[model samples]
Target chain A: MTAPSQSPIYDRVALIGLGLIASSMGHAMKKWGLARSVAGHARTAETRAAALELGFCDEVFETAAEAAKGADLVVLAVPVGNMGALAEEIAPVLKPGATVTDVGSVKQAVIEAVAPHIPNGVNFIPGHPLAGTEHSGPRSGFATLFANRWVLLIPGEAAPDAVAKLRAYWEAMGAFVEEMDAAHHDLVLAVTSHTPHLIAYTMVGVADHLRRVTESEVIKYSAAGFRDFTRIAASDPTMWRDVFLTNREATLDILGRFTEELFMLQRAIRMGDGDMLHDYFTRTRAIRRGIIEAGQDTAAPDFGRSVTGAGE
Target chain B: MTAPSQSPIYDRVALIGLGLIASSMGHAMKKWGLARSVAGHARTAETRAAALELGFCDEVFETAAEAAKGADLVVLAVPVGNMGALAEEIAPVLKPGATVTDVGSVKQAVIEAVAPHIPNGVNFIPGHPLAGTEHSGPRSGFATLFANRWVLLIPGEAAPDAVAKLRAYWEAMGAFVEEMDAAHHDLVLAVTSHTPHLIAYTMVGVADHLRRVTESEVIKYSAAGFRDFTRIAASDPTMWRDVFLTNREATLDILGRFTEELFMLQRAIRMGDGDMLHDYFTRTRAIRRGIIEAGQDTAAPDFGRSVTGAGE
Candidate 1:
């Protein structure tokens, strides 16, 4: 924490739909003094009140239009389902030449939904900060939430300066920013985020049903591998729902591939072909190594800890 | 570190394989003073030397038959693939009244593979100590590895005394004992362990391939939900292979169900069905809470840290 120095990422930034991502941005902005002032809006009055109470913004507005009035940067932090509606609502009130972005999980659908509603003078950069936790709402944010996380911005090769500014804003917010095509972004996230989440939800559902039948306190014995699924399954419901609803095709495509492979492994298991399972498991370990080497994740030692220890 | 006591769990305990579970059991047995002596065998002489050098056992032998000689309790700690062979190898030298058990991930397979191979006078009770870390080898275990972890025993109604003795042995090794039929044990573990590990392997494979095609450091951005898969994927390959092969039917059954639910969620995402995704995500959170409450797992407050901040 240094003495706050003025940053030029944005002036009078307006956040529409103050949830996890938006509140996080506010925290980052306040921590770095990136924005001249921060104003936010939410559909529910309680959310707006909570945002202000949590000191996530300079002021809270009742409407997206009010929040966007004269702000140089307008961030739509609503769910994918509400992106188009919020874009339409703020179109009239957006300040001239203001750079508008979002933090939605789904990319292409958001582009199609939000692009049509942006005013011609305003820069529309469909964006997603690939940083969040299971917690949601305005109060569940902290300064380091976006630290070392990705913030993917899809500009469709339309505005490099606008994209650069947005990227810089994310960088200042402690996020690693990448410029990806909206369709590719959707496809990548489908495998990385969407399908994994759905699979987790399904597994937990199965476990729940098992609890009913076995009466064995199966959940009590969930330490081995099931706990990981439970954590993913515990993500923000509304945000995930919107992501799946908006990014259906990509998710289904990857999920189909996953099931095909899973079926092959299942067949091998059933046939007692230990070779297949062994080969697959061995190959998977290489990927884990690659991920760690590529700096995509922590080594096994620092996995759950911020500090390092031996592998065992 | 306490004075020696007369009532050791066994006069001499022979471990047929010195892998992660076995090594950990040795540590636990020493901590509890539950064994007069701990000795083990490895397939390779080099591994036996390494285990002995690492002080994992009082004596390390190169052959199962040699290890079982004069030992009152013989524990098969080999992979399910090697269980039958090891049982046959050790049967000739096993003491007349020795109790034989195992720490295989799959119970039914071990029972079918090893029970008939045991000598006529030796009592066999198939067991699984549901505790481990991703690391393997003799040096990667600790005395507390089985603490608070479940140890499933399948006695086949053979002898109450044998079951009681085995349960007491595991209890002395710091595990809570649970008894069930062999097939039921396989089914429960298929849901709780095997299927989860398979899914993790599949996902890591998907992410790795995706990374190669993208030519970007995908795993660096993996903190979102990918690291869990990596940890699970990094599990001992041969052991997991044996588990999948042995627990094939149940694993496939669960995989089919998981695939069905995954497809449903994928469809909902494609259809822009936010309601469906929200409902599924919310439901899964409850399962996570159930696990935490049951003390089967810790809450994901700090990315799966134990509540007490204690070592596993």
Candidate 2:
């Protein structure tokens, strides 16, 4: 059931990382009064200070255990690679019956890494908010980052009331919440997110290594198509490294499919098969329309970035 | 030397195709008084009618020859594959001192296809405006489409005066103009535009064909990274097909580099080499910053599409 407008969903919430997702959540929770007090912890003192100065947290702690000591909800918002270690450190201080969730991209690896360290009395649910900007860091977040976006939760053996409460908290923050299996979520994200990101990083890398085409030339003419690839490749490096390492199998599987299709198109190009190229290009156009119709993307041409600015 | 502000750069300008580039030029020329009369021709009557109704042209003709008759500047804005035929059709009617240019993506191929049909005294200059949205058609144009964008010109045998006049006209439309060689232009675009499009098309195709991940799931969760690919892949099939077919050598060269780099990353993933992935991703980030610093893109996170709308 929906809570009354502006009421607190949790008496105290602990954010174990002060990055884009966690900072955005802090802003949204504070702006909407979804939590009575927000406590944050960052590995770096600089990030903790910045988060407090940004006013997204009521208090900042030097260690994860200090942040989770008395909180009702604990969000492990660090990189996938650090999930297990962070979970271990916070395990001893997690209040009994408290809910622990995550905002990692790959669900299965995060579940495996963090689930073990979570205390038995603590309800552990892995989650991922299907939203982000290429920019990262504590200050790179805003209150509306989750508005109209999807937040998927994997409630593994967690009590219904805990899952429901977490879902209600996210809904209060203006996100559409959904429940999904960890394995399926990993596979789906590999197809939609991981593989695409890997491809973009590879393309940008290729451009960078091309000596004949000067870097200045690439930068000057990037508005053509490679500009979009650069934006995707510019995302947080640590986050992506962890993503590829943790979600290795699914990402490699989808990448294999991608390479196969790319070779087919490459063959068509080499053979001068205009018809096949035309047909393939035409078929892909329909999926773009589907995304717009599905409300996952804007129908505005170039995402309406023209004239005003460049596209994403 | 710059002409008087708002003065006509050419008495008559003929556009061979009423697509995005041609229609945008028509609108910009009229708005800025760069051309006294804008004449247009399209293969389809529906497009011709739409162009005329949109008030981007003073007259609409049934054929390219009729449209080019007595014009001082004729722009061949059709697909690369159709350039030779259109040039042949308009060759006889070209004025002795007229300048014939094109807006094709690939310069060398467009030059090869159309140069033979140019009259002895007519000047042929191949130009490409590095600006456009995924939207196509005669109606999907605006007066400011080329604002602050780059328009590359390859002045093969065009007289100094003729090239200068065209450059002045493009500058008046708010584009920064640069001169380049045909072969180099094709190669650079293969890296910046052609190869990227092929990769995006391939990625979207892979997503579409995956049985485990439904099409709706791909579309629903696209905001993670795949959304940008869809926009690039959604571009006009005919135009892109001609681009790949005509620029085969360069596209293949770049694709070769791309595949090599992709394989390297794939290996790193298999071996869980987080350092390699992190190093590669970090290097790519500099290119995006270079593009933004060069004014080719916006620094706004997610193209500032958060909350207000979806990124490109």
Candidate 3:
């Protein structure tokens, strides 16, 4: 399995919606020779043209149905809200015995929307890659986007062989693959991704609403801390909107907990409880150390922002 | 004023609390010949030894009073809560014409705490350099830490010549200097720094409290979004604790607004209001663009984290 000459995992793979994740998958698959042919589709002619020009895929189609034709694997990589319609469009053209999966952030919603459209003998495995940049479009992707990142698979009742093949494919692409149930995957992601994004978005909004501080001042002085929130909030708005809508319960639950914790900290600040604030801050520091130890992020200061000269 | 051979801004400089900011000041002063001699003192012997060994100061003193002796400029780089005590310690030994300033995050508290200790002829200017990293201590200091970052000066009743000299010193060190009243500086920082750090700390705490997700799992999947929070939360706990405690009213006020905005977003999510989320996310994206345009941060994806091999 580790040999360079290993056969391609799929004879043909189709990526529907040539955005960041899809384009990144195309690059990773091509770099590792994980698929014999990679095909892509997007709603706009410009995106399809850009994908072909960027060599993200061997062929580009204007419609999802056309892209799925003759492919052994089909990846739905659009926003979560569009997953159901795209699944329905490609259901008729999906090849027998083909395996279909998605790279949506919310697993339960994707499973609920796309599972019903899977044809008999076709595998429907829902997956979410726990990685992304605060960028979008075909040009934003690179082969290393998935390197050392987690790609969670929610196979439900998919055949064992099909699940194994998909796991091997993700492994080849440099992602660590694990199987998880849909609901658990959604909840975990809420705590890790969705709620954080929402908080970042809300903070940026709050900063903008403060009339006393000019926007120029906010931008000029952002290096202190607010710049990180801007980076997270800059992520593709459409993708995040769909994530919140589809993962409503889990995201809300996590957000509720976050507000409660924030309120406690606020009370401590109001009461001038320095000891409590110090203890809370110290405890949070350990979590950051754990992330660094796990190799998920670097120990480099400022997320290595200074190296780019943009930080200066 | 821009000539390279201009006389040193101060004949002798004393830095109280030889941590990241003071050590960086020492390095910057040496790099640009901004000061004739640099002396430092820290509460911990280990820190003072490290500062001397790292060549961060020309001399290390046993006490704040000893360090301030014969110094033309004395900078209080200690935690906000320690400013008053250190000021009292160094007041008797301060040179008659010395200019005393601080690099505390909260300006009003520093002014209030240290103002009474200033000698008859000494200038007291409370300043806050809006620059830092998650890492702390003498080892984390670097000359370029303040490059292109803001250093806000709350001069209050300080002489104009004194403020100009300090501004020139910081400009030589590559920081842009801006003057603001102490109260306004505290409020602005609360919006841009203190509250953001608090929110990040709270988010990380919430993730840690989630019993359903193991800490290992949270760490493993942190790249999704939570990793940024971890970085912000990892900032020096003592410094942050002091910031919240010292700037209680402004920090709590900002936190109140943040909670209100967060609640609105949370309600939208709970109600499955995708339109509200999409609009809010869109508005936040504009603020990010503003930050990038102002050169406060980079447009590079992931804060340029991907440039380092750790991102892969």
**CA-based DockQ, model 2:** 0.57
In order, what DockQ does each candidate have? 0.48, 0.57, 0.54
| Candidate 3 Cα deviation (angstroms), residue B307 | 10
Top candidate, metric lDDT: 2
> Stretches of candidate 2 above 4 Å error?
A1-4, A296-312, B1-4, B296-312
Flag regions of model 3 displaced more than 4 Å: A1-7, A296-312, B1-7, B296-312
lDDT of 1 by residue, B1-312 (tens): 122234787989998888777887787777778888988888888778877777768998777788899998988888788889888887888888788888888888788888888777788988887777767887777777776677888888467887898888877765678888888888888787778888888877777666423634345446556666677788788888878777777888888778777777767766766677677778877767665555534421222344211111
Tell me which residue pairs clash in candidate 2: none
- Could you say which candidate leads in DockQ? 2
Report the alpha-carbon TM-score of model 1 versus the true structure: 0.89
**Each candidate: how many clashes?**
6, 0, 0
Query: Tens digits of per-residue lDDT for model 2 on A203-285?
Result: 99999888999997887777678777888888888999999999999999999989999999999999989999999999999
Clashing pairs in 1: A244-B269, A245-B272, A248-B270, A295-B220, A296-B219, A296-B220
Q: List model 2 lDDT by residue over B32-149, tens digit each.
A: 8999999999989999999889999999999999999999999999999999999999999999999999999999899989999999999999999887877888998787777767
Choose 2 or 3, whichever is better by DockQ. 2
Report the Cα lDDT for residue B31, model 1: 71
Clashing residue pairs in candidate 3 (N, C-alpha, C atoms within 3 angstroms): none
